[model samples]
Target: MHQFISVTFSLLVITGLRVSVQAGETRPERSISRHYISELTVTNGGRWGSWGHKEMCPTGTYAAGFSLKVDSAPYAQTNDITALNGIRLHCIDNYRRSLNQYHEYSTVRSEVGSWGRWTDIKWCPSGFLRGFALLVEKPQNTGDNKAANNIAFVCSGGAVLIGSGTNWGEYGAWSKTCEGKGICGIKTRIEEPQGSGDDTALNDVTMFCCS
Candidate 1:
């Protein structure tokens, strides 16, 4: 009986199915798989008048998402002509990994309007991306300062894609969902009101990924 039990145990180990003993019965030990963040990087558009400083995530951790604070703070009696505000980077451990590392900046382009380019989106290595969150500026009025207020994201087999929402004058909120087919990266958009003289920007974005 001892030799038979020893042979059975060896076979289980060889086949990657170690047995567990519980309540006088034997069962296979279930395997638990987990994921974690590996690295993070950041950059920005070289605009004038200190829009904010660049930031990075800790080594071996991933960004949870992003947030922003405008210089004028929506409805101010006196708005800033042009000044860099503050920005934040939400960080997470293994449970949440995502992406869309971008920043945009623009100055008053005459009465025609304030315009800026969508900062290039960042992607994860091959099949590591999973989902994302966004932090739009969303000011109260669209006269002197502008910020991205809405955004959208999609995770598919080939690549992750992003788009902007309709409202441009008010910062909405972070995205509700973070599940992606295989979210590997992030994209961003910036818009200005159809008037003259307001520097608007999409300050930053956060991304998540799988281990």
Candidate 2:
């Protein structure tokens, strides 16, 4: 019986180690060759939540499109409102390529809130994303507060792309344009759900430009 128990324990140890290695492999390593050229930020982001991990596009790629995660209006109005939940960056290898011509690409995002559904991706007609503006609602002392509502991105091709997010807050000034090729990474500030208090999911965001 002791021999059998010892074998079982050994197997468990080996299995645990294998699982750990596999989990580590799932997270891609950041390449040293890919460096951020500038950080884009706005002033009107909500004053809630902690900043999430910064996620970046793979080497040789830049962000050319984006999507939003937004809570349904009916659900938000009835329950604790958290309008903009998350933002995702869709990357492409060639910024000059047309929207429909790209066949292979990758998507990346930082931390996302627990609420809302991801919207369809909005792509730039040409070039990469260079600047951004955010819409945010002011604090409500006693009413429902939805911090970040929508986002707009300015492409290097001079096209402006807007997201399908809730219309709650006013848009802030556009962030400084990318000093390099385009925006390549994203980091967000999100507030977790409060048990019985006001909850504002996405508060702020920062964009990283890469050369």
Question: lDDT per model, in order?
Answer: 0.30, 0.77
How do the residues 1-211 of candidate 1 rate in per-residue lDDT, one tens digit apiece? 2453343335432221111112122121211122423212223221222222223333343332322333332432244332222232333333333332212111111011122222222222222334433424434444554344333332232233322222333223323333432322222223333244455544444333333
Residue 13 displacement in candidate 1 (angstroms): 46
Off by over 4 Å in 1: 1-53, 70-75, 79-84, 95-211
Distance from true location, Cα of 113 in model 2, Å: 0.7
Error of 1 at 91 (Å): 1.0
* TM-score of candidate 2 on Cα atoms, chains taken together: 0.82
Clashing residue pairs in candidate 2 are: 136-169, 137-169
Leading candidate by lDDT: 2
Off by over 4 Å in 2: 1-33, 75-77, 95-100
